[model samples]
Target: MKTIHKKNTTFLNLAAAALMVAALVLGCKPNVSNGGEVQPPVTDGCTITMSAGANGSITASPVIPAGGKVAKGAEITFTATANPGYRVDTWMVTPTKALTADGQQGDAIAKVKVTANTTVNVTFKPIVYTPVAYADLHNHLTTAQPETNGIYYIEITGLTAPDVTGNSIRDSASPLGQILNSNRQKKVALKFGAIAGVTDMSSCFNGCTSLVQVSDIPNSVTDMYSCFKGCTKLEHVPNIPNSVTDMHSCFYGCTKLEHVPNIPDGVTDMYSCFEDCTSLTSVTLKCEYLDGKFHYAFYDCSRLSTGSIKVPADSLDDYKDNADKMKAEAEWFAKDE
Candidate 1:
């Protein structure tokens, strides 16, 4: 409680300051580097740098992205996506090593190991491809007839999908309908281009009795009258494009087709659409309405379960009671019955 002398107090304060300095020096010594400078957090990792080859970007996985770091021995993948009109031509990796590559051109991707600091260089080039054009092999001038063997054969080998949507160029305007049949010569393969500008598919394959296979059709089609009426051997029918509105007798006599794809809401006329599809078991006609025009649409779909008409579950009664009620009744009869 008594006042302390200044000389004695100064000596005690100096000793306290010495202890504090010693504790700090011990706590911080481990973090000092050889230069006596505080070091950054240490890490055992490598850097991976990716840049555009030509108007495109290179994406990677398991690599420190965006000027970052990844652990050594990590497996990394770099994928190239070329911009429009450009394609990936080559890759240049600094400190080069063997790389496992996959995919083609503009969509190429490669895998490599992270051993050292690396730089990825990709080169891109202009893409070149043949302008696709389709020619109708059968129509009014060349009715859907078969070869001397009485069978039609279609081989679509090198065709690829088009970039445009809902457009097609029809090879023939007045196609007779059944020319797609497989003539004992070979299977009918239509891997051809998507006929985008085409709008009419009426009677496209109507009487193809031996037509067992049909490729995907263009989504630009609108008319489909009597398209597959007599494709008796076709077991499975692909979905027609949603652009179709005129469905008059589209599948009238396709005796072996088992199901009908979803009918789009745009459809207004379904006159005799499935009149004679004898083996038909189901249909997806969620299209809320069918004004009397489809009365005989299912006339011969005898095998179709009453429940097979897959409408919105809430509107089953409405379909049977209102939309084309006559068709609901005609669903019982088959060809010649």
Candidate 2:
């Protein structure tokens, strides 16, 4: 081999020595920084994004750090809330994160400790159910007759949740006769709702001496001949249905009745709707069709004076005597004040 040049050898030696010195300085560096232990190299953390389905929201505890970024070992609780008419269906976690609560894989609440990037999707579903509605119908009297005395009760079908405006309902034409003729019982409990099919109520509660209540007059009735002829203890008559055409002797002897319902404009015959109502002081006969007849409609109402009827008496000039009988025994009609 050719002999090496002196300058080249010297330069090589210098370079080798310089590299060794640099390595020593770097390896001997202090393990401290600003009086604190040195920290590991910085690395990116995991990311978590939540997706809530329609009409629902996800609430988290220890908030999944801002922007869905969290430490490697951080734990987060995700709760799903659904609005009215909805229920929680599932909490779908991506990559199958660690769940603290035991339940089906995709349903129920989840407490997750993230190991990597995660995504939780909340899926809500509409609750499914079916509802049923119906009614009961019974025939003949069911309640046992009173052990003693005059106590009677009757049930009316379609009374529960009835259509009040309905007028075709069917019921007993002579409910009182059926009850009294059997036992001659006195006390009566007339439970009823809207009258939808009843067409007659003649003598329905006639001669109920001990009947304290004359249940409301039916709206489906066309007749009321002596319906409450002798309900002496009845304190009130709620209303007279607009469908009634005849109200002869309807409240003929309700002596204790102080109030009478307004006579519907449809009534064509009021022979004695409120006859002998001695306690009544005022009356209204607003029927516009009443031209000349209502014979003794309020006859013997001793407390109601002549002219006490509230009809357009001038329009009934020919039957003033009948109109007079419509008022209390001597009471006069009430003129417009």
Q: What is the overall TM-score of model 2 with all chains considered together?
A: 0.44
- Model 1 is weakest, by summed lDDT over 10 consecutive residues, at 164-173
Error of 2 at 31 (Å): 99
Candidate 1 lDDT (Cα, 0 to 1): 0.60
Deviation in Å, model 1, residue 159 alpha carbon? 11
Per-residue lDDT of candidate 1, residues 1-337 (tens digit): 2356777798899999999999998786556777888766537588777777547778776546554677777778887755544556777776667354543333356776767777776778754432222344433114454333233334332222322121113322133232333232232323234443667667666566656545466777787777666767765455678888888877888887765667786787888888878877777774555567667777767777645676655645556665345445423222210
What's the TM-score of each model vs. the native? 0.46, 0.44
Candidate 2: segments with Cα more than 4 A from true spot: 1-175, 181-185, 194-196, 289-292, 312-331, 335-337
Residue-pair clashes per candidate: 13, 22
